[model samples]
Target: MQSLLRWGTERGAKHSCLQVMQDNAPALRLYEKLGYKEVYSYWYRIRPMST
Candidate 1:
C-alpha cells in the first residue's frame, strides 16, 4: 500500500484516497495507523434480482 502511494506521488498525485468497508476493522486500523482519518461515512444497498 505504501508503495502504491509512493508511485502515485511520484506521478504528481497530491493526495490519495481509499475506500474500506465499515465493518473492516483490521483495514481501518491499518489506514489509521498510516495517518488516514475518517472524512465521512456512507451506506450502500443492493436490490435483489428478480427470477
Candidate 2:
C-alpha cells in the first residue's frame, strides 16, 4: 500500500484516502502506522425507501 501510494503521489496525486467502517480496528491501525491520520469522519443510517 505504501509503495502504491508513493507511486501515486509521485505521479501528481495530492493525497489519497480510504474509507473504513468504524468497527475496522486492524485496518485503522495499519493506516495509522503508514502515516495516515484521521482527517474526517462520517455517520450513516439506512432504511428501506419502500415497504
* Ten-residue stretch with the least lDDT total in model 1: 37-46
After superposing candidate 1 on the true structure, give the runs of residues whose Cα lies further than 4 Å from its correct spot. Answer: 48-51
Q: lDDT per residue, candidate 2, 1-51, as tens digits?
A: 988998998999998898988899999999999888888998888986996
In terms of lDDT, model 2 sits at 0.90
Model 1, global lDDT: 0.91
List lDDT for all candidates, in order: 0.91, 0.90
Tens digits of lDDT, candidate 1, 2-35? 9998999899999888899999999999999989
